[model samples]
Target: MLAYILRRCFYAIFVLYGVATIVFFISRLTGDPVSIMLPPEATVEQVEQLRRALGLDKPLIEQYGIFLANLAQLNLGDSLRYGEPALRLIGERLPATMQLAGTALVLSLLISVPAGIISALKRGTLSESGITVFVLIGQSIPVFWLGIVLIMLFAVHWTIFPTGGIGTWQHLVLPAVALAFNMIALVTRLLRSSLIEQMGSDYVRTARAKGLLPRSVVGKHAVRNSLLPVITVVGLEIGSLLGGSVVTETVFAWPGVGQLLIQAINYRDFPLVQAIIILLAGVFVIVNLIVDVLYAVLDPRIQYK
Candidate 1:
């Protein structure tokens, strides 16, 4: 297990490096930051000074080396827009994003698990058909659109919740529901399929023949075995939710990393953009590694070299 974990960690390093390479080049391709930072009528010397200040006059390889060195030392550079450490600016925004994503994940699981079980158990019945329809509609809708509709309905028309901001619990309702809708639909559909397949397996029949209760046969024998795929999907989805909330966060004005990311992009703030990308890539790599470790924990048959 230790060896396997070490291998995974090594792979994660390669993945993060790939991300850094892509982000570094893509950020540079967005045109010169000095041009965007300076006024339209700025002189040549002014642009040269700005380039020197930002180290843009240096060779790309040299700049990349410096960036990597700083990253190794846990220094994410200073934001051009905010004049603060990129890491600190992102840190201030992370809690709101985390709160939003965490709540959405929990809500999705709470909704999907039971619905999936019931739909699978009643495979050919109206319950199953109804669940399929719900899944389709839920997955088809866009999160940003859903968030807007929710805000209009619950906050504008009914006044049940706040329309925006991140100060209190009331602000979380629309965004959380919007984020969870697709996730719940996807998870429930995957779980339903897995459970249905497991229910018909030979071991499930053996359990029933051995006088196991229906609940035990389904929950212990079938559900446990079928959860491996569901776990993988849910883990990836949660990680995605954490890093990909830019749209939802923007729509809701949630004051999270997503909003900050937009600001960085609009202003051509290379330091902030690079830091955000690195942070997102790191988060995704860590989540996937944790999921890999969980596979051995969930099923001892999954052994590591």
Candidate 2:
């Protein structure tokens, strides 16, 4: 297990480096930050001075080398727009993004797990059909549209929650629900199918033949075995939610990393953009590694070299 963990950690370094390289090069292609940062009436000499200050006057290869050196020293450099350290800016927004994503994940699991188990156990019944239809609709709707409709209904019409921004728990409700709706559908459908398959397995039949209660057979035996795939999906979705919250955060004006990322992109803030991308990519890699380790924990039969 230790060896396997070490291997995964080593691979994660390569993945993060690749992500950083791609983001860095692509951001440069979006056009010079000097053009975006400077006023239209600024003099050519002013532009030259700003360019020199930003290191854009240097060759692309040299800039990339400097970027690598800074990364090696755990420095993300100063934001071109904010004139603050990029990592510091990201750190300020990280907690809000984490809170939003964590809330959404918990809400999704709470809604999906029991619903999926019930739907699977009661297959071909009215409840199962209803849940299937709900899942289909939930998955089909786009998150941005869902967020808008939610705002209209709950925030504008009902006035039950704030329209946007982060403050009280009420402010979190709409954004969390909007972020979680699709994840809930995905987890529910996957869990339901997996549990249904597990219900027919030899182990399930053996447990039943041993005179175990139906609930015990389904809950203890089948559910545990079905959880491996569900856990994988959940872990991956959690990572996705962190980065994918861009649209939801924008719609709701939530003060989170996703919102900050949009601002950075709009201003062509290369340092900030690169820092956000690298951080999110690292988060995704770490989450997947945790999921891999959890496989052994969830299923004792799964052995790691």
Candidate 3:
């Protein structure tokens, strides 16, 4: 297990480095940072000075070396537009994003796991059929549209919750629901299938023959065995929810990394943009690492390999 973990850690490091290298070069290759950062009427000497100051005058390799060195020290450089430290800006906005994503993940799990189990248990019933339709609709709907519809109903018409902002619990409802909807559908489907398979297994029948109650047979035995797939889906979805908040945050004006990324892009703020991408990638890597560790706890027989 330890060897497997070490191998995965090594793989994660390489993946991060690869992602960083891609992000670094792609940002540079796509456009002229100096042109975007400078004024239209700038003199030749002024442009040259700016290039030297930002190290654009150096060879690509040297600039990358500087970036890697600074990154090792956690110095993500300054925001092109804000003139602030990239890490500081990310730190300021990270908590709100974490709060939003965390709440949405909890809501998704609470809603999905039970719905899945009940639907599986009642597989052919009218209620179960209805739930299937619900899941289909949830999966089909786009999150941005959902956010808009939610705002129209709850915020504009009902005026119960604020349409946008990060002020209070009321402000969190629409965005969280929007973010959680797709995850809920996906998790429900995954869990439902897993539960059905577990129920049909020979061990489940054996447990029942031993005179265990149906609930205990399903809950204690079937559910745990069924959880491995659900765990994988949930972990991936949670990471995506945290990092893919760009559109939802934009629509709702939520103060998260996604929104920050948008602002950085519009201004061609390369440092901030690069930092945001790296930070998000790091978050994703960390979440998956934790999920990998969880597999050991979920099933002892499952080795890391």
The TM-scores, one per candidate, come to 0.96, 0.99, 0.95
Off by over 4 Å in 3: none
Top of the candidates by TM-score:
2
What tens-digit string does per-residue lDDT give for candidate 1 at 1-305? Answer: 88887888899888887887788878888888777788999999999988898888999899999988987787889998788999899999999999999999999999999999999999789999999999999989988889899999999999999998888889998899999999999999999999999998999999999999999998887888778888899889977787558988998899999889999998888889999988888888787878888888888989877
- Local error of candidate 1 at residue 133 (angstroms): 0.7
lDDT of model 1 at position 150: 96
Judged by lDDT against the true structure, how good is candidate 2?
0.93
Candidate 2 lDDT over residue span 189-283, tens digit each: 99999999999999999999999999999889999989999999998898889976989999999989999999999999999999999999988
Residues 120-142 of candidate 3 have per-residue lDDT tens digits of 99989997998899899999999
Runs with alpha carbons beyond 4 Å of true place in candidate 2: none
* Candidate 2 lDDT score at position 208: 91
Q: In lDDT terms, which candidate is top?
A: 2
Model 2: per-residue Cα lDDT at residue 3 = 97
Clashes of each: 0, 0, 0
